[model samples]
Target: MQHKYLPLIIAAALSAMSAGANASGYRFGSQSVSAQGTADSNAAEANDATTIFYNPAGMSRLDGMQISAGATMVVPHSTFTDSGSTRFTHTPTGGTAASDYVPSQVTAPSFYLSKKLNDKWTVGMGMFVPYGTKITYGNTWTGRYALSDVKLESVTLNPSASFKLNEQHAFGFGIDAEFMKANLGQAVDVPGSVMALAGTPNAAALAKQIAQLGGNPALLGTAKDAHGANDGKDWGWGFNLGYLYTLDQNTRFGLTYRSSISHQLRGSTVWDFSKVTTDPIVNGVLQAASHKANSAALVALRTPETLSANVFHQFDAKWAGMADVTFVRHNRLGDLDIQFPGTAEGAEVIRQQWKNTVRVSLGGNYVYNDNLTLRAGLAYDESPVKNAELTHPALPDSDRMQYSFGANWKLNARSSIDLAYSFLDFKDAQINYTNACNPLATACTGNGETTRGTFKTHLSLIGLAYNYKF
Candidate 1:
């Protein structure tokens, strides 16, 4: 009797909360097309309405009503090569390693609007994607037990207000409302769970059957490899602050801070047991233990906060330069925990132990003519993972460099267009993770499995936007 339904025994590959963002950790990073024209170093420029995201105080500099809309295209490539991966039984996990995981390219969008209520006060709003990702690996990869596929996304809406205290000083505040969703999938070991029942009642017969069937290598885990998947969505809130200081008509400095947001993703877990052995004894025992069709699941997490500083200077009619620095408090993602009800192992944890990080950027602009301007920049971004030991298949992070360039076209006195491009290369890094099953659970099946491998990677971004002054 070949049965096709079974519950989970141990969830080794649980979650990678910070899995698929273009920026370090879970942030999309590129929020504005004009900003990307200078490698994202335009915080003090306040030339467009997008200032609502980077530095709201800059909004006070806008006249009348202004709006900006844009979109970015992100293409990523990820490949994995296994060094030494094994099953819970200490046997080699027989399978082909993944050459590439990210199936294709992705696109993100943004919009901003600002209204100068008076000479001293300005109000604005922004709707943009702050975090998002999409990556998939083959189901039979060497690290199948650790990660099979993952997709995550988030959107934030910000309503801001700014006050011009004087000719040289301005302050801004905003309310941040965000929503996030995620889905993660991985493979399960049914034979491993059966073996966990060894020495118990009616177990001698099952053991003999397993050993006899092992004679044919083709049937090894084919009929016993199950699957586990989880999906959920949630909403969170936070705040932001911005300040702009103008030392003179030719120079300006901007500082901004974003607060952290906490969220509890509520979802459910589904297990597939459609390929279990036909043996009644084998099927009955496995089904009778820790079996459930579905169960409630929850994951508690917090996004990180950031502090950014920037200076923009105009040297001449054809010369301008800017520099920016940002500090990310990624320590907020220390330990990620998940809860699953009606299971032997009711919960699982993936230790991140992430560290704080920094990003630095420099850029320059030149006016080729009255209606055209060219932009270029370079930036260095750091990852939060301390080392390979803490890296996971979900988020194989590393330090990287951003190379960017773009241009601006002023169509007329009230309208303009911006186009930018960037290429990012992450320093090579490794993933070293141990078995994730909690042996202490009553009916666990983890046998000290480990996944150690490296992933292939590539990233590029192209942004386009239109700005209007009404």
Candidate 2:
């Protein structure tokens, strides 16, 4: 049974809450065409099983039974600069420096399915990622002190149903169960006097001081008690709603809305120092206390909501067009609070002035023969990261345009192979980061530098699906 479903798992390899714009907040766009044509319009015409990830109403158009399974390999190559003279330092010497940084390689995966119950109703289920991001800077990086590595992931399970009202209208709804997690750790390299006065007698004390300041184990190498922090596991649920309308024999329109979910992730967090220090006291005493205190500070996070509409038209037997537009509501994530187990310090609050965003797409399909088809599409996606607070490195998003090409090869009456390739071009942008002010010295804290650089990415997809009409 597992072997038979390996493809499904591979196809559903990735479904994060933070992918790009395709997943929930990620990118797992549907791969199905329209009823009257191939998928080439805005997000409105979710006409296939992939619609389980987009909107449920599209299920209403199915006849008896259908199933779809496929996979997507998402590859993104990114670079960053300490642009505004962003500060970073090399160990052993501990001097200020600057250099271009390259992030790690990322691969994302996905899966989907739908079924019809009767003439007036349809039911379906889909597992996909809608939110997740990660960035790992190489060794000898400049911003090593301020940041080094970040990882975030999110997934969703959707069960939906659609009802046909009359000949021209339909409605659909679904329940979303979501899970999310995040991991982060960075090094902070500042001058010695700044540290001496900051209350650390040596590297060991410095590690303790920083941990008290939410600093991770990236700073002091084998001397300080540097350790990583995990946001643990967060679980929550939301809902999806949509509508579809047929204008005539040749045209159809669709609209969908996905509600935002709030997660109060509850899990165990460990702050271990095996990598930070070899000294027993450093590891056994102060380090142990910090870990105990840190675990008590885990809390909640808010995901965003979105809305989209699509229009698809079958101009002729060989020619068809598709277009879609979508909007995201990010204002709901304005503030996040993590309470501490010790009232001596209280809770930590991170503020986010996230703004709404939009995406637009257009596409078309061509049938070359009875068993083969070709597809092409273009989309413009907006960035969700704000310039002011963009340095966490969990994400560095910017506006981009995607050009995609794909083809389908039918093997028999019930099976087919699908392949697609897409290239993303992004505009260059700058990031300026401000660290929390040092209570003792205000000079360097208030005086931070910026770095300038650029980024570009590409994606490849290969999927196989079995379809049986009964």
Candidate 3:
């Protein structure tokens, strides 16, 4: 029965592996093409239904039913160069010869709809991806023992309502239902230390068979180069609150807050020994041992909360300016703990020690004419990970600068098309990681290994959207 579903599982995993996110800390920013053009500073300038994401209270600003749909193409380029790496046995001493470690492109899509329930009320709904990540390294790379691939994907459904106290004040609240999944893969080395136990009681025959199968008898018990995979999925719930204040016809301010969410993911781990050796006798023994080590795991993950303030000012009908300040409580993600049920391995904890971060953006729009609007913006985003030691291959986050430009073309009084482009430059990052072997494991033991390298990344986003008012 499990074999029948193996292919489907693998396919789903691969699909998840191809998704990626934007902004710092795996948060995406292309939910609205209109906002993407202005470097995501549209919270207070709620001119469309997309405000359902940035500030739901802005929904009260819309006069009628509105629908907005868009997609963003995210193109990321990451390169890693080997500084120096050492395996447990100190046999391999450098990183992979291949330079590119991340995929070149991916896409994220979003949809939003808003309706004015009455003169003092508005309702809205939206679907989008808020957090995701994907990274793939050469399978035989020097760091393969530590990590080879990692994927994290999440989607959120939001339903919201806003109440207008008067012409100047509006309050909004919403519920978030989010689904997330994660997959990780790595290689396990077969070390000589394990092979040394060949003459021992339970290992004698297995060791002899491995030696006869062309495996170095000298490295009898070590991880003979097996593969390990972990995959899981979960659902979490949260809420958001927003307030909008219109100082006058020409100026307005918006504040929004999104609550944090916690997820307990259920998953399983599989260790494939067939990849380690080809001998039938040795394969049978190792396969059985690998299956014995397989166990179900429960992992806990938390997404951060965020607070944002936005300002919009209209100097004239032809010129308007906007600014935004956003703070993310990333410190909540202290660590990731995975517990194996019915296994003696107990649990494994990876410390994150992340810090709260802030992002600032400034933008302006120009009414080129009655039918065209041009937008430009600049932003600086901080990373939650403090340094290289805290950085993981799955999310190699860094402080970044963004420059964006966009345009909105009005096809008629009730329809328009939006286009935006953004360029992101991430500061170079350093990685220094080490994994120690477990002496209690009977399969392999040779101390551990260290991987040191430099990572460089940059990304470009192109977004397109169509908006309609009824």
Would you list the C-alpha lDDT of every candidate in the order shown? Answer: 0.74, 0.53, 0.73
lDDT of 3: 0.73
Residue lDDT tens for model 2, 32-124:
322112222434455457676666777787766666665545455545544433432111323234232322234444556677888899988
At residue 397, candidate 3 shows an lDDT of 67
Ranking by lDDT: 1, 3, 2
TM-score of 2: 0.77
Model 2: how far is 373 from its true place, Å? 1.6
Count of residue pairs whose backbone atoms collide, per candidate: 6, 49, 10
Q: What is the per-residue lDDT of model 1 for residues 1-470, given as tens digits with 9 covering 90 to 100? A: 00000111011111121223456766788899988888888899888999999999999899999999999888776667789987776667777867557746677899999999998999999999887666576677887777677777778999999999999999999999988777777776555654554566645554455456543323323346666777777888999999999999999999999998877677777766555655544443444443534666766767888999999999999999999999988887765656665554535556677888899999989999989999999889888889777776767778888899999999998999999999888777788777566222444333245788876565878899999999
The lDDT of model 2 is 0.53
Q: Estimate each model's TM-score.
A: 0.89, 0.77, 0.89
Pick by TM-score: 2 or 3, better one: 3
**Model 3, residue pairs in steric clash:** 189-223, 190-222, 190-223, 190-224, 191-222, 191-223, 192-219, 194-221, 195-220, 195-221
Write the residue-wise lDDT of candidate 3 on 1-470 in tens digits: 01111111211211121135456676775688999999998789999989999999999999889999999888888777767776655556443554566667778889999999899999999998787667778577767666677766668999999999999999999999988777777665554334434457657766666677665533333346666777777788999999999999999999999998877777787767665554545655665543336777676666778899999999998999999999988787665555666665535434456788899999999999999999999999888777877665556667889899999999999999999999888888777765444323543221255667777888888999999999
Task: Give the winner by lDDT: 1 or 2.
Answer: 1
Deviating ranges (above 4 Å) for candidate 3:
1-19, 89-95, 192-224, 284-292, 436-448
Per-residue lDDT of 157 in model 3: 98
Error of 2 at 141 (Å): 3.3
Candidate order by TM-score, decreasing, is: 1, 3, 2
